[model samples]
Target: MRKTKKKNKIYFPDPKFNDSLVTRFVNHLMKNGKKNIAYKIFYNAMKKIDLIKEKEDKTALEIWKEGLKNVMPHVEVRSRRMGGSNIQVPIPISSNSKITKAMKLLISCAFIRNEKTMSNKLAFEIWDAFKEQGEAVKRKENIHKMAEANKAFSHFRF
Candidate 1:
């Protein structure tokens, strides 16, 4: 390779959950370098989740992890050009990429939601994902379906 690959930076876990994944999600949720605000929103959402899903045996962090897993897409289609034609090729995604995609989808959907605040919208999205119903989950399902439908093009993967 002409250029060296960039090294991955280590992420410190959030205070409440002490989980690196939560820290990553909060980092993605952060805007304009407002990390404190992001942390507050994420913690508040987790608290709300705990308050609402009292009967579940899982902790709020575990529920959030499940929600993240629910929204993670295993395969995705990418446009590739070959023989003067463009084709949609299904490719497996790495775990980190899957997590990142899920986080982005969740945040985007949360932003579009008609909620009083960003934290509330994010909390609702997290709850819906945990229950296996939400825009983010639907998006993941759609991605999987698309990948399955285009499985015939798997041979075209670069």
Candidate 2:
């Protein structure tokens, strides 16, 4: 057991977007340490989003950020073992972990999409999230519902 919390490493922002959030997402999307490929996929998806929403006044980066914001969950459930039984406890999520969860959901949903390319799938997923109607958003809703349903158990939260 450690006495102190671990320190998070500072990440450099992406070159094109200059946002550390994008860097974090690309890092999560990276497979087998192929960070360049991950960055390419993300940038390509952003470009595709721009082309698709040419009529909209919003930029692709703005859309992506909004989408991620929409998918961030405020609460989640955790199982805790009590005296003689285990119970699910509803707990509020930390700001940092909320972003991590949203990014994971987006990437997982994108991977399962029936698109020819990773960029295409990611573009569609992000757009759906922006519109508040995607797997990531749906998952967030489900999590909220579960948290609400288990609100009585919140006292067990650590």
Q: Please give the lDDT score for candidate 1.
A: 0.89
Error of 2 at 73 (Å): 0.7
Clash pairs (backbone) in predicted model 1:
none
Worst 10 residues of 1 by lDDT: 5-14
| C-alpha TM-score for every candidate | 0.94, 0.95
What TM-score does structure 2 among the candidates reach? 0.95
Question: Residue by residue across 1-158, what tens digits does model 1's lDDT show?
Answer: 98897778799988877888888999999999999999999988888888889689998888888988888889999999889998889999987788899999889888888989888899889899999998998989999999999899999987
Model 2: residue 42 alpha-carbon error in angstroms: 0.2
Question: Model 1 off-target regions past 4 Å?
Answer: 1-3
Best by TM-score: 2
Which residue window of length 10 is worst by lDDT in model 2?
A: 1-10
**Per-structure clash totals for the candidates:** 0, 0
- For 30-109, candidate 2 gives per-residue lDDT tens digits of 99999999999999999999988857799999999999999999999999999999888999888889999999999999
